[model samples]
Target: MSINLQKGQKIDLTKGSGGLSRIMVGLGWDEAQPAPQQSSGGFFGLFKSHSQQQIQDIDCDASAILLNANGKLYGREANDCCVYFGNLTHKSGAIRHQGDNLTGAGEGDDEQIMVDLNRVPADVAKIVFVVNIYDANVRGQHFGMIQNAFIRLVNLENNAEICKFNLSENYYGMTGMVVGEIYRYNREWKFNAIGQPVKEASRLQLLLNMYA
Candidate 1:
């Protein structure tokens, strides 16, 4: 069955009646050309330099991407941003990982985190992805301006969509996080309410407790 989703809404999976086995998480968006900040100046009066890179037409066929379990989240400009893995950690701190994509261009330009159901930690009830637009706020860079972004879950065994979450609109600060619940029932794996991007990682813990 196709999962229904709307931007800025969250779904609670703990209330679902069953458990899910293999879940595939995917991230997608409409690709838009990035505008150049300014034009280049040259000594030659006859020379005119283009300020922005040519934008490509949105590819309807590349709207979805399957995340690899070993994949890592990355920023469009790696030097300008940082990606962290946040969850229930023993150290109670975010673990930073090398970004996988830097240029926010073409298809599959966003970062993705994958979870293998069989390898999930026994104590881990959920996982979250945190995007730090800039290591410091002074730079004035953030992800709030991002558009047409979404997360999806796929059933690996059958290559089907189990659920999806949208992140197109929100008033939350630039620093944001999205979480998905893990549950088991009837010897099968199922996920629920995998929607809405949360502003805090701790909220994931709260949702897990609420549904567990």
Candidate 2:
């Protein structure tokens, strides 16, 4: 059975039940139904007025960063410590992002990142998972228009779900979220569910700045 974690909760991932090396982090979300469009005196508003425009799809980018023991970026360059759509795999081969999901339109996990716990360097201590709205400000999109956001961890060996955290907090104006963390604790790997919202510009830079 999979464990459902609440915000601020923590759980052991490798302290017992043998050692785990391969894992998958799954992040899923759905765009909220669009609000009813105002009628411009047409049949079912089939023809939108020139001033009215359809809502653009929400593009939530899921990314991860490796942090040192002090909770800071471990790599010399930003790309060295982070993995996202542009950089699919890390140089160490310990982490990889499957791909980018242009729209949060499907069911289940919209994005996934694979992690080899054993392959991660000793210097790295924590892996933080985050999601942010791409070009949110200019596109007029935010987490408020998002629904059913969640993050989960699965054992790739057998495809068994370990734990899941649902982001149920009100994030109307928030543009970025620090969803969770996987870190070393007591010589074992553990997960921390963090549903903190970031009201900043919803950019990866805003998240990296937290580590800096």
Candidate 3:
């Protein structure tokens, strides 16, 4: 059985079981269905159904922000350490993004990041996972329109489930979320569930807040 994580929960990545070297971080979500509109009709019109608009294809991107012990980002050669669709792999070959999903339509993981725990640089102390709509403001999208959002860490070595976090809160005006973080603690890596929502214009602004 996997550990079901709640907000503010923390787990040591390298403890309990044997040493964990490789792991996959998977994030998933589905576009929420809009509620039906109500139209006034006859005396029995209360149960009448109004036309429902098709749900727009909202694009949600997953990104990994690699930071050093000082909580600062080092630019990757291609994508400048902000590993995402634009930049799939880091210079160190430690963290690599699977790809981008234009819409959260289907099932399973919409985006995934593979982390070779042993390959991570010594100076690099943290990896922050963030999910944000590509053009939230322009598209008028928010987390409120997202459903079944979750993040899970799996042991790639044997495909054993480590931990999983389901974002069970309703966010109405927030465009992005700092889903979680894996940081170095006592020389061992640990995962923290931080489902903090931010209404930033872009992902860059959210990164700045982590440093601030």
Candidate 4:
């Protein structure tokens, strides 16, 4: 069974299992339904004006950053060590991003990042998970419009879910969210649910602020 975690809660990654070496972090969300359009009628309100503009999908990008014990990023470049759409894998080959999902459509995990716990370097302490809208401010979109936002960690060995966290709170006017974090605790791995919001223009800026 999977464990559902609450905000600010933390759980051991290998509570009862020690052979777990590979894990997957999955993030998923749904595009908000468009609001009802207003009618501009003419000729005794017989005909209503309509727009030809097409509705775009919500492009929420998922990213991960490997930070050290001092809360600092190992690589200075954005794509060098950070794993995301542009840079799919880390230099050490410990972490890798599956791919970019242009739309938050269909069901299940829209994006996934695989982590080899044993492959990760000793200097790397934490893995921070983040999600942000592609062109939020310019397109007038935010987390308030998204629904069913969630992040989960699964054990790849047995295909069993370890824990999951869902953002159920209202986050109006927020462009990005630091969904969760996986860090080392006394030589054991643990996860923290941090549904914190950010207003940065891009994911790079948000990460800089996080490690700064």
CA RMSD of each candidate after superposition: 11.2, 3.3, 4.7, 4.5
The model with the greater TM-score, 2 or 4, is 2
Better of 1 and 2 by TM-score: 2
lDDT of 1 by residue, 125-147 (tens): 33443333323133222344345
Clashing pairs for model 4 are none
- As for lDDT, the candidate ahead, 2 or 4, is 2
Per-residue lDDT tens digits for candidate 4, residues 1-212, read 88999999998885667677899999999976644455554222223356534345668999998788888886667764478888899888889999999998989999999999988888889999999988876666678788899999999998899889999998777889999998999988889999988876344566557675
RMSD of 3: 4.7
Q: Write the per-residue lDDT of candidate 3 for residues 1-212, one digit (tens) a residue.
A: 68999999999899765889899999999987654445533122222334334434788989888887778875434355578888889888999999999997788889999999889888888998999887877766788888899999999989988999999998777888889999998888899999998877345556545654
Identify the runs in model 2 with alpha carbons over 4 angstroms from their true place: 39-52
Per-candidate Cα lDDT values, in order, are 0.38, 0.89, 0.82, 0.83
**Best TM-score among the predictions, by candidate number:** 2
Runs with alpha carbons beyond 4 Å of true place in candidate 3? 38-55, 75-78, 201-212
Task: State the local distance difference test value for candidate 1.
Answer: 0.38
Model 3 lDDT, full chain set = 0.82
- The C-alpha stretches of model 1 lying farther than 4 A from their native spots are 7-20, 29-99, 136-138, 179-212
What is the TM-score of candidate 3? 0.87
